[model samples]
Target chain A: MPLEDQLLVERSKKGDREAFEHLVQLYEQKVYTIAYRLMGNHADAADLAQDAFIKIYQALPNFRGDSSFSTWIYHITVNVCRDELRKRQRRPTVSLDDNNSDGNNYTYEIRSTAPGPEEMLDRSETQVMIQQCLDSLNDDYRTILIMREIQELAYEEIAEILGCSLGTVKSRLSRARQALKEKISKQMEPLSPCKRLAK
Target chain B: MRCQDVMELLSPYLDGALATEEREAVRLHVARCPKCSAELEELRACIGMLKELPLIAPPTGFRVGLMEKIDQLPSQQGSSKDKNIFDRVTGIARSSWYRVVAVAAVMAMAVGITSLWEKEGVQFLPLEQKPKGVVAVHEPQKASKEPPVVKEQQPSQVGQSSEPGASGSKSAVNSKGSGVKQPDPQQGNATVPVITEAVKKQVEGYVPKPSTGMAVVSASLRLDVVDIEAALKSVGSIALDNGGTYLGSQDSGSIGIKVPRQSFERVIGALQKLGGVLSYLPTEKDVSVQHQTAKAELERLKAEQGELQTKLTSEPSQELERQLADLNQALLKQIDTMKQLEDRTNHCLINITLQ
Candidate 1:
């Protein structure tokens, strides 16, 4: 941990809100990115990222710093996503037409300085295509892929986070990569078969 | 190897994680086979595309909303047992109904001091057991049943959190995941966390002790209450009085509270009397075997790791390296499981549905 981060963590443990908010400002981007990648939607990404931070705040006292604080927070972000994903699996599927039943029933407040233009710029053809492919994947494949590929977590760390053995992580990550490749191919083949399959 | 065999190793092969022979075999196979080569290429492209996903900002008001949510959270640090007991006594001392008792206790303290000093040889004490003053013994109900004995000198402020088990192990810490100081009486004089026999007996039936397999007990109740809100408040208060936390309504709208294991039945009985009991189910789970197994595994792995460290000093081989890495991962997994087990075995969760 950086000296500043170490100091911030100590102060946060002592219930210093300013120190905690500063800590949040420092990692909000990384934590939000992890949430966005796992959740694949802005609304859920926002909700769950905040949930992750709350969990981080509550679990801060118990943090023995066994792992790097980055790794610790990343693990929390992933776990929050995993739990929500699992709960969604168990939840009854709601129809798209059911407005009230939709998860994001609350109206999004218009920000004076919304990132509409920046988000528009970010949504190039390739980003959307790949995200669509990622969203098409099963929960396990998507989660493992995000952790390994996007978060770039080590296989040992992924294994520890998912509470699986090393062998399981390797095989599952390999399968996830294969699954993602097939999804990407399926998505790309629709746009231009010649370009996709070209040598 | 066949295409299936080659495909299974391609991701790790891309990341340079395969064994040397497997890497070489996959490389040679992909070079020769168009199908395997295309699959490998596609996997590489997919990873590249994933990496291209831009870092997007969170929705507006993310920080403001998060801070607001955090403000509602119970203060974990301030809720230490000492502060809570002090606050409780202070709250009670301020109440009008308790003035007579308070005044009487003040008078009694003035009168008991010389006798108490002579009998107990200057307890060097400010006042209470578990709490920290004369106010604790003023509980007229408890004072009559059990004669007051001076509390043992406290260890450190950090040494106190929850009730200790028979062994005073870290596992004996509360399920709240608070700071658990593993007090060793065998250590120097200052570190003695001596919970006197009398003190242990006082809280024996009420508090959770994380020992004897840490048996967690809980109860679920379905009640026909006249008003849901009142029932919820009553249930929450019951939890508070028993030194537990109310978990509030889950998505299913069931009111939940987590109390100490020993207090599970008492809480259940009290709740049952509140209204017409539609259904009640008490559950108990003993996790001693699981706890013991994880502990043994941790010990064994640590010993093996020590041996490997000694070997690494003499010869640093890849095989030894792999063994050490695997052992560390195993240790991490074991530690996570142990933590979950301790958390579960620490408290009993009661979910009550009001009809």
Candidate 2:
């Protein structure tokens, strides 16, 4: 934590509304970005980000600074989005006690916009195509890819956040990367330099 | 190692997480393999695109909305410092969902039986209703050590509410020192001065000095009024009376007004008189630094534009045309900055939120 953030955290913990707003302004951009990436839309992203901050405010008293404030807040953000995704999926909450082999069996039923590679001729902007591909992926793969590639969180940190083992994190990241590659190639074939180079 | 094995290890290899022997094995296989190498590059490019996604800014008034939400919450000085609220809720739900449902079902059955027993004709239980009477008279203790719990559930309305611990004085704000939270807004009349002690302190601490120079000043006032539309119209008329223009509303339940610097104090006073204030924030920025910088940059850009115009007129060339375009871009940007500063210095903006 920076000296300024430490002081602000101290003030916010004491119920200083001004200090708390200052903290919000400091991290709102990154939090909003994470929410936008995970939620894939503006309205839900705004709501999720606000909800994440509200939870953070409610939970600040207990925040003993075990991790850096950013990590804790990002973890909260991820959890909030995960809960929302689960709710939308209407799946039973997976029990942590269950001896699930790799936490990989729980795949969300995404309405795949995944067209075949041959049909991927109408090219969009690279950024737009990439986001579309991300939106088409299963929730588990999308979440893991966002955590690893966008947030750049460490493997150990990712494991701790997902409550999974390190091996699980590594395996999931690999599968997510492969999934994203397939999605992108399905949506953006000619635009993919590697595909053209390989041909 | 076969190509299949190399392909599986490609992701971890990109992250440099593979051990020495395994990394060497994958590396030697990819050295002769084009397909496996292309797969690695493709994944790398995909990750790069994901990383390159631009972060979007939240809509305006996000901070304001969030702060208002926090204000309505129960006292912030909480005791549970070990785990977060989400974790606690999720833990219970995951571990004890069945137990919780069983308890709820049992309670429902008990309620049904009790209602049956209470019926005169349909007596579910046979005996001792009239045999023995144990009347326990409970006294309402006003001086109990525990304070009353105020559930601020609904939208908190402003103005003349019979709020808890409030003197109900019509002077608007609770000028006295009290830390009482507003009673449930779903119920009637939280009609006291609910301007919190912290808010009052902050408002008093910000004493704006008289400014002869151009300065941009603004204030944020939040009131939980019963009628948002009426309050907004009332505030607009008040601003107009003080020679201010209504900037209209950017969002629901909020209005923005711009008043001349001279009547800024009068406008603030009149607006405070409109309803009960939930929170107050006053801010002033001496834009001398900005004004001075903008003015100097504006002058410099104009002079450069003049020079470019002269060059373009004398020499008809593509180079001169390109220079002219570049100068226009810079000149337009400089003017935009200066114009923003001038707009800021013109008047004071009062952001009134009627919730």
Candidate 3:
């Protein structure tokens, strides 16, 4: 934990609201990104991130120092996402209808994007295509990829946050990349038959 | 490296987590393996694209907004030092009720003392079987039959009395008399005494001494209920559920009952559901602190009594010996009262006054 975060946590537990504001300002963006990438929506991600902060406030006093504050917050964020996932599973919905659907709904794609960022210009169709490719991934695959790649969490940290073993984190990251690669390749086949044939 | 193995390390490599050795192994293998190399190239492009993905900062004025929200939050009621002082003062205030109860008790006790003091002291004939000192005097209603000793005693003689109320004087005498008589059972084991005897013994200080151990716990709850029976049933059920027997109850107004401490909350919740709870007060009474002090005192008394018994056997001075016996008797009396108080507190008294 940062010295400031540790100090803030101490002060917050003593009911110092100012110290806690410093904490919220520091991590809200990172926390928001994790929620956004996992859920693949602006509003839901924003809501989940806000909810995670509220939980952090409630659970701060009971934090026993077993893990780093980042890791603990990461775990909480992931838990909130998983709960959102399970809720969606319980009551499936058409993904495009409502962006702010009650957490019990999500969308899935048949194929995932290929591995790597094939240099797309900023704000170009390709960039949009790449994001769509990411959206095509299954919840599990997208989550592992986002945590490991975008968030740059270590296998152990990812494992702790997701409540899985290091081996599971490794395997999921592997399959997620493979799935994305296959999806991207399949999407590109019609655009260039020669490229497909050459491969 | 196999496709699966290469794929696992690919995410870590993209994240820059791969150790030098593993990075070398993957780099060396992928260079010759066209398919794996292509996959690695694509993975690299994905990382590049992720890097360029627009950074979405929290909404405008994120920190300012957050700080404003946090500032609006409730602050700590007091600092540690203040809480410490509050706790100490509150503790004293909480237990001060005992002093109030004690004063009332002292006044009630005054009447009994005059009768015990006025009667001729009961002297037992030495038992043939027991030692000469082992005398048992049968004085059934001994204090009760002695008609109002308060009426006959000279006002001036009672605590250097200045007031005309000698009947009330008996109250003061009984209070002192009760205080002193409270330690006799430690003298010897005869027969365990009963009700009036127990009261006299307590007034005189015999067995099952007065307890300072009684714990008073209070709890209240609010619930929506249709009628009084439902509330009564709920309270009864709570007590029954928690292995507590309901002692007493009131219904037309709010209900009140004493329960074991362990049953405190369960009973309170049940009663709360009896009506739409307008207000609630819940508290725990812990006699542990008082019990601990009383036990230490009892232990000291027992040790002193043992020392005096030894002195009574071996010493020769008459005045010294009588003084020792009196000390031994006082300690014994106190020890008994202390034990009774312990029993009372250990019972975990939960008093529920519900609306």
Best by TM-score: 2
Q: List model 1 lDDT by residue over B211-319, tens digit each.
A: 4556667778899988888888899999999989987698443798998876877888899988999999888887777677777776787688668756754554447
Which residue segments of model 1 deviate by more than 4 Å?
Answer: A90-123, A194-199, B79-355
lDDT of 3 by residue, B184-263 (tens): 22121111122112222222333433334456455555455666565666776777677776665654534445566565
Candidate 2 local lDDT, residue A130: 70
Per DockQ, the best of the predicted structures is 2
Per-model TM values vs. the true structure: 0.48, 0.50, 0.41
Error of 2 at B179 (Å): 23
lDDT of each model, Cα atoms only? 0.68, 0.67, 0.56
Error of 1 at B300 (Å): 60
lDDT of 2 by residue, A10-44 (tens): 88876677899999999887888787778776566
Docking class of 3: incorrect
In terms of TM-score, which candidate is stronger, 2 or 3? 2
TM-score of chain A of each: 0.81, 0.78, 0.74
Rank the candidate models, highest DockQ first: 2, 1, 3
Q: What fraction of the true Cα-Cα contacts (under 8 Å, chains A to B) does candidate 1 also have?
A: 0.51
Identify the leading candidate in terms of lDDT: 1
